[model samples]
Target: MENKTIILTGGGTAGHVSLNQAIIPELEKLGFRVEYIGSKEGIENELIRESHPEITYHAISSGKLRRYFSMKNFTDPFRVGAGLTQALNIIRKVKPAAIFSKGGFVSVPVAMAGRLAGVPVIIHESDVTPGLANKLAIPFADHIFTVFKETMGHVPKEKSTCTGSVIRSELLDGSAASGKELCHFDNNHKVLMVMGGSQGSALINEAVRENLDRLTKQFNIIHLCGKGNIDERLEGHEQYCQFEYVTHELPHLLHLTDLVVSRAGSNSIFEFLALKKPMLLIPLSKQKSRGDQILNANLFKSQGFAHVLEEEQLDAHSFLAAIEQLAAEEEQLIHAMTEAEPPKTAYEMAKLVAAHAK
Candidate 1:
């Protein structure tokens, strides 16, 4: 019998690609020939290329789907059309059993292409609100998986399943001692991790830097400051360590984290939840995004899984106070996290996707 094959599509941000990463191994283990389709210049291309060389990678043309006005808006529809054509060609050639999409602009064309190719498409939405790209792809999707129960109301009830998020297995096996050794910090002080998502957050970086003196006195800080966002002047600080970003060591760093200050990206927050790390979320302001982060942070806060300090309200002083509050409420947050059901594992999600395949 021919080996089963599946195509995974998603990218724009790490969040969009992360669930695919989590499930790829499971899919491989289940005897599927995994393939990926993403933008030529996207982070997904790099990430998938470097991490899973076994899977074939196809680069396709994709245009950003912006809500606000731009000259690109007129031209981007043509790019999207070109992307759809490219995706259709690839899908027809591969003749895969199913297409799994993590819901980004890149996945929109791919999802449509899957529909046109008569391939089943399964889309996973990570946020409380569906992103514009996911909204556009919904009608073409045969099944929809969501991280939040609230998201079901927005989708066709017959097609939507609240599967929660998929947490990578590697993240759960981190050694805190290894993290402490890597960071050159002793176990005497609490370790605080500040992450600003894949692209980094200027607001979070500045606020954390401004409060470093006060923060360092209380905790050892591991700052994943994003690519090219590191402040060289603070490189030699005794109690603070900063990296452009971490891949292999992220698990260790997360394991060592006593508390977290981060953006409310759905993937990162869900990972923190899986690890039971108490967090202070500073979501991007409405001006910067579609307000999905704000909603994510609010959901976490309401669920007692995290504390939120909106970007508009964030300053050095307030940021520090929120950290203190997170520290004080650590036990409550951990309790909530412990009682919370973990998301469907990658294996389970893979099975669900496979069951929907042609």
Candidate 2:
């Protein structure tokens, strides 16, 4: 088969970028050459350039579209238009067969450019509540893919498909079978892993830090602190380890964790399900355009794959208490979580993109 060239756009946060990371190898296997277009300042561009340096990289200045009201919104259109111009140039130069977007503000311009160039545009929405970029780009896209069935109702059904979420290839491998062994926790330990999505959550970190002593007594924790203002001392608890990020040992860490305390980003929630690890989700506030996080948390809770707690309700004592309560029902929770197992989202989406690519 001839190698098909494609441009992948998504970024600003890990959720958007990680999907690009997950699909690259699969796209390559199917004889598709992939390039990434993202904001130079977005997390995706940095992570992609570092991890996969050889791929084509183009940076654009696409400001975010805030939900409530912000002065930046007025000027964002000009930036988006400039980004679209750059993206059009790239598309003409690369002549990609298709464009696969992960639905971030940065994706808007690139997908628009692809549409203008008559390239097939495919977008993957990783939220229960789709973002403005996805909503605006939907009409231009040839196909739209979502991580949750709940999200499909918000989009035109004719263009939408529920394909779960595309996670990095490494994360989906041996997550269950090696959970206990690789993560250095015995069956009785009730391992706990706390992550605040890609950038971490300050509120979650603060709450966890305040109750570290109580939590560490029974649960072993691997916490990704996300550059919060919380003190590193954590009351001098020996059971907790912290990092700003975790790129290398994520799969091992998730495999070993019994329960994940996380932000309700669609990627994070789906990662837990893909790993069959129950979660204690604390979604970010809707004011932060974290409405998707809230939606994701509610869905996971209703599905019985995870428990949801609002950030405002997170105090040290209450947090610890919730952990204790959930730990007691670990077996039941894990079982409920398993019902959403073996998410082949990346593979399926890759296959679709490959088949549709010019």
TM-score top scorer: 1
Angstrom error of the Cα, residue 165, model 2: value is 3.4
How does each model score on lDDT? 0.92, 0.79
TM for candidate 1 is: 0.98
lDDT comparing candidate 2 with the true structure: 0.79
What's every prediction's RMSD, in angstroms?
1.0, 2.7
lDDT, candidate 1, at 184: 88
Query: Would you estimate the TM-scores of all the predictions?
Result: 0.98, 0.92
1-358: candidate 1 lDDT, tens digit per residue: 7539999999988888888988999998898999999999999998898888889999999999997999998999898999999999999999999999998899999999999999999999889989999999999999999999999988899999998877888999999999988888865899999999888988889989999988888899999999999999988787899998788799999999999999999999999999999999989889989999999999999999999998889888898889998999999999999988877688999999999998
Q: Give RMSD (Å) of candidate 1 vs. truth.
A: 1.0
Model 2 over residues 29-99: C-alpha lDDT tens digits? 88788898999788887889987887989998888877667888899889988999998999998998899
Candidate 1: stretches off by over 4 Å: none
Backbone clash numbers for all candidates listed: 0, 1
